[model samples]
Target: MDQQRHTQKKLDNGNIHTSPKISTHLDIEVHGAQVYSHKVLEEFQEEVKYSIDTCKIRGFSEAGSLEVTTVRDANRDRNYQVTYCQDTFKATCSCRMLERKGIICRHVIWIYSSNGVKKIPELYVVNRWCKDEIRMKMFDYNGEATEDVDIIDGKQIAMSVMWSEIHKTVAMLMGKLKADVDNFSSVIREFKEKLSLYGSPMNKQQQLKKIFGCSASQDITILPPKQ
Candidate 1:
């Protein structure tokens, strides 16, 4: 038993590894390296630099939220509302750049920096925009033709291709489908027909279990649409 324990310990020690420290514009002096991708980090850094130079914290609410004013022109200053839930670390800005682009905006960057926040709050960093997304093998292609030799995972590559095609189809139909109620309902009905035609012969419960290794009854409860 002692020999077995020693062997296990040795194997564990061999597997132990540490990664290098990454410095970002948010906080280079401390533990601010969790931002993942350097491109996103650089953009945040640029915002921090701009905020330091031109942005100012105008006021704060009793709820611990802040108002930051970004000076675009001397005559036109943009006021951004920043709300940071201290308990949840969920931060949001009124600029809506983060909401639409999945990236935190300059206004929020200034607020975090001013508040002595060394590490970016995890809630503000969308995983989709991070460098780690590539590492995760979520999607492969970047909508570019390349001649470079690279080993591609077949599953991820196929999924990426499928999603690209779906996006194109959806974008083309977006305007016309939303033009009227009948158009929208017709499209949905057609999609349902196609799905039903191609769907598996197995019952919904069995199919769900076979595909996802979980029971539909336990994992999913289909509810009627709200009126």
Candidate 2:
């Protein structure tokens, strides 16, 4: 019944309407702040400033890895070491800011600024906090790629084909149901009766758990609780 209403609305509109999505890269600082707290953002800014002022790019290795050195205080015995990869846009610091706090540290910020990198890449951004992550193509399902469409472009194509079919089918059904209420009710009732024989459909989460066996609540017996 809900599906019928949803379908009818789209049919009345004549065409499916979709809003354009804003890119995450448009305001990297805003996205970053969403993932990290304001306090962390301030600390990150200060780190970037410190990196620019106090840190120096020690040199680059043969494999395009950069080595950066930073000094927080002259009294400190050891300097911070930052390893950056130009090709992958990945940075790791011995300070473990990225590892522990899941945010870019001062050394990486300095390296990026020194290299004229204007925005943080999506690779370093956490998806749970990003607005654009939902709009992006989903690469994997059940611990593997959907039909092996692992890459972004490939997954986009797969999703486009899927949504197109769904829209077309729903729109067609909606138009039919809107034209004849009695027929629609009769058909839905018959469908429900027939479906009752097979039991109800599994929700998305249940379906995924069945496919991947990753349900946290799955039962396990350990020596029968030492009976």
Candidate 3:
């Protein structure tokens, strides 16, 4: 009986060593990286600003995040912001309104629900690496003819490839810039309309001619509309 008890005690002390380690080196290859975008972050900001219980919004442009605190009452002084992992999407807000019974918050959802990525400062378009589209289209072919050339293949046709690429990139950037300018112009027009309605400032057309030097009511003639 004593020997049986001793054997049991030895087993309890891990003398057999049958237990396994809690951690192990994973064989998985983790291509871990962060991706961020200002556009997405702006969307998050907009969403948070419209959410209930929000008292103030303080965003850091450098860090690419906004801290939104909630007020306990509309006419009170107390405020509380959500606490959650930005990457994990778990949050806690002042009001126990969201799912998880006061664990998740509205601000965090606003950040991600608006289209938040996993990284900071927009890693997808970071400019850290060379543009792949340019590389693929421009450098895809070496231009060296596979067959032997005697310098008499009708001037080699001289594939003007780089010029095409330059033109394309310029066109793309120009289109983007033009769209932004147009949007700005539209916003200005709306503001001018509001001002005119309130009788505080000149009309939209007048304001445009005054500030931008272009008549807001002018006709946009592309080839004069076929005359």
Candidate 4:
């Protein structure tokens, strides 16, 4: 077990040390290094390298809101159509890589690079592949609310954190509890008793506040829709 753990630690350290060297494109290094997770970045870097080496733009055509560029792949001797929208900075490739796997294809990357796009567009950056989304904070170890009280209510954040922590703890122990039927029943009864300890039933407004982490009085700004 110790040797296995040592090997895993060494591999983790190696990935951390070599992650920065994965991206050869300046644009990817600048825009994606901080935003994407390590595995996603590595895949994206591979596409970027493929785009630079084997993909070439044959021709481009402009249609009202879309620009279609034809890219030829030298490796496969195939032509791919890339449609890009200047308004939203959204691009789609005939390869359907982004649609199928949530990773942008070499065809789209080549088109974007040829167009002198310096940064990866926000529309192409999926939330699931982002570093911040993967590392979401679900618990407060210091037993204190976040410092964003002025912008967002601290009580709401605290409630959200607590519920997340509770869910995580229950999930972690569920398999062990299921191994023994009597223990599982006892745990359920204890949970019911603990729940009853919170005296009165919450009103509809209070229940909504607890679940959503926001009151009706909070000024909620709805941003414009993504294209």
Comparing 1 with 4 on lDDT, the higher-scoring candidate is 4
Candidate 1 local Cα displacement, residue 26, angstroms = 4.2
Error of 2 at 32 (Å): 4.1
What digit string (tens of lDDT, one per residue) describes model 3 on residues 1-227?
55965764464344223332212121110011111122322333333434333434443222234334343333344455654444544444655544433112334444444344332223223332211112121111224442222242433344445457646655665647678767766876886788787667456667557666676545655554555
Please give the range of 10 consecutive residues that has the lowest summed lDDT in model 2. 15-24
Sort by TM-score, best first: 4, 1, 2, 3
lDDT for each residue of candidate 1 in 15-124, tens digit (9 for 90 to 100): 23323343444573233234445445556555555655667666666544433333241122766677775555566777687878776666666666766777666666
| lDDT of all predictions | 0.57, 0.58, 0.39, 0.75
Ranking by lDDT: 4, 2, 1, 3
lDDT of 2 by residue, 1-227 (tens): 55965764554343224322322332444445544433345555555555555665544554435444443422233467667777777777788877776667766776776666767777777653333233333334444444322254665588779789757766667646456756656776997899889988677887788777887555665545544
What residue pairs are clashing in model 1? none
TM-score against truth, every candidate: 0.42, 0.38, 0.19, 0.52
Q: Which stretches of candidate 1 lie over 4 Å from their true place?
A: 1-34, 64-76, 134-227
Best by lDDT: 4
Which residue runs of candidate 2 sit more than 4 Å off their true CA positions? Answer: 1-40, 57-61, 64-77, 128-227
